[model samples]
Target: MTYCVGVMLESGMIFASDSRTHAGVDNFASFCKLNLFERAGDRVIVLLSSGNLGGTQAVISILRQNGKRPDCPSLWNAESMFDVALLVSDAMRLVDRRDGQHLKKNNNGFHASFILGGQIRGEPPRLFRIYAEGNFIEAGDQTPYFQTGETKYGKPIIDWAITRSTTLNDATKCVLVSFESTMRSNLSVGMPIDLICYKLDSFAVTMRRRFDPDDAYFTTLGKEWSAGTREVFGRLPDLDW
Candidate 1:
């Protein structure tokens, strides 16, 4: 299992994903789930993927392979972020069609989902949650973010503190804290996390980082968040009942 999130703000956008993948309690490993397709001064697309590892990897591989062909309508030529989402959805469907039946017969899984967010030339930054079935929904003023896989544990923090107006810096902190909350509750989702912060209209990614287990900032942030949460809870008035 994994956790991936993307937030679109007035200033820009933030993307993050955990690297943990496990077959069982005794068998665990890490794989970077964050994928990027960037063309300086043209577009900056970020994909945070989750679900069946094979399926997600195949889908991403297909997108990358197709994006190189000028004859195909790929992410490189997509005029808008909506088009990019469609391209991703199409690639996902292609993978499902090829592997779904075989996986089902073996009682295996071919489910994969993605959070796609970025800026295409001319359009503002956009975010979408693409489902396993290849259909997707866009983030709007009311819902300016998207999450996939192991999402419930980290959602409350984002819901309470994030808004469309949140700054990239603050949003980055909120996102990391959300991940900390999730890792505390679920062992399957963990570090090292891949994070990217893209400023609007830059058409380039200026900031990207990987937070390993020993990463000082991430470690400190997690500790501070845990302590702060406990302190806040301690201050809450107790029930008389």
Candidate 2:
């Protein structure tokens, strides 16, 4: 299992994902689910994947390979974040076409999905959640974020703390805390956690970080959040019942 989130705000965007994968407790491993396709001054696209690792990797590989050929439309050539999402959905469909039947024959299913978000030259930053069926929905004013994989454990904090007007720094903290909340409840989702904070029209990713198990800041953040939560709970008025 994994957890990935993309938040689209009035100022910019935030993307994050945990790097844990496993077949079982004894076979735990790490694989980055975050992928970037950037053109420094023109665009910066981030992809956070979930579902079957093999299928996800295959879709990414196809995107990169097809990107190399001028005749093929690719993330690099896409004019808008919407178009980038379409290309991703197309690639997913391609993978399903090629390997879906084979995986099904062996009793496995081709399941993969992505959270695609970023900025292109002429447009503001945008976010989308692309499903396994080659369809997607964009983040809106009412719902400014998208999440995939093991999401339940981490959702409340985001819903409570994030908004279109939230600052990047605060959003980053909220996102990390959500990750902390998730890792605490699910061993399937572990560190190192990858994060990116992109400012509007920057067309570049100047802030990127990865927090491993031993990272000082992440550790402190988790502990403080736990303590704060308990403190808040302690303050709530007791019921007469």
Candidate 3:
């Protein structure tokens, strides 16, 4: 399991994903769930995956391999963000065709989901949530972000804190907060989270970072947030039947 989040704002976008993947609660390993496709000034696309590890790895490998092919539809030749998404969707379906059946037979389905967010030359920045079925929907004003894997616990923070006008920094803060909330309640998601913020029209990632258990900022954030929550709770009146 994983918890990956993407936020789309007027200024740009923010993406983050946990590194932990597990077959069972006792079996935990750190594998980066975030993948980046960068082409300098041409485009900057970020992909965050959650679900069956084998299927996700296979899909990413195929995307990277096909993206280098000139004659085929690849990320390099994608004219717009929409085209980039289609390429990803197609790649996903190809992987599913090859592995989905086998995985199903083994008692696990082709459980893979991705959050695609970034910008390309000649277009405004965009963000999308690509499904395991090779179809996707873009983030719009009404829904300026998307989340995958263990999403429920952290969703409320984004729903309450994010908006189209939110600054890149503020949105990043919100995402960190969301990640903390989810990790507190779920053991499936864990440390060394990857984070990136891309500025609109930059065609390059503006900021990229990672946070682990010992990371100063994350440690401080967790303490402060927990203390704050406690204080707030203490201030509330007790329920009277």
> Could you tell me every candidate's TM-score relative to the true structure?
0.94, 0.96, 0.93
For model 2, the run of ten residues with the poorest summed lDDT:
102-111
Better of 2 and 3 by TM-score: 2
State the lDDT of candidate 2 residue by residue for 127-229, as single tens digits.
Answer: 9999999899999999999999999999999999999999999999999999998999999999999999999999999999999999999999989988988
Error of 3 at 203 (Å): 1.0
Q: With candidate 1 superimposed using the best TM-score fit, by how many Å does residue 115's alpha carbon deviate from the native?
A: 0.4
In order, what is each prediction's RMSD in angstroms?
Answer: 1.7, 1.4, 2.3
Candidate 2: regions farther than 4 A off: 234-241
lDDT of 1 by residue, 1-241 (tens): 8999999999999999999999997999999999999999999999999988899999998889988898988889888989989988998888888999999998975799999999988888889999999999999999999988889989999999899898899889999999988998999998999999999999999899999888999889888878988999999999899
Q: Weakest 10 consecutive residues, lDDT, candidate 3?
A: 219-228
Residues 1-241, candidate 3: write the lDDT tens digits. Answer: 7999998899888999999988788789999999999999899989899888888898899889987788878888889889888888887888888888888898877878889988888888888898888789998899999999899999998888799998988788889989998999998889999999998888887599999878999878778877877998999999999
Candidate 2 lDDT score relative to the true structure? 0.94
Highest TM-score: give the candidate number. 2
lDDT of 2 at 105: 92
Candidate 1 backbone clash number: 0
Q: List the residue pairs that clash in candidate 1.
A: none
lDDT per model, in order?
A: 0.92, 0.94, 0.88
Instruction: Give residue 183's error in model 2 in angstroms.
Output: 0.9
Model 3, residue 47: C-alpha shift (Å): 0.7
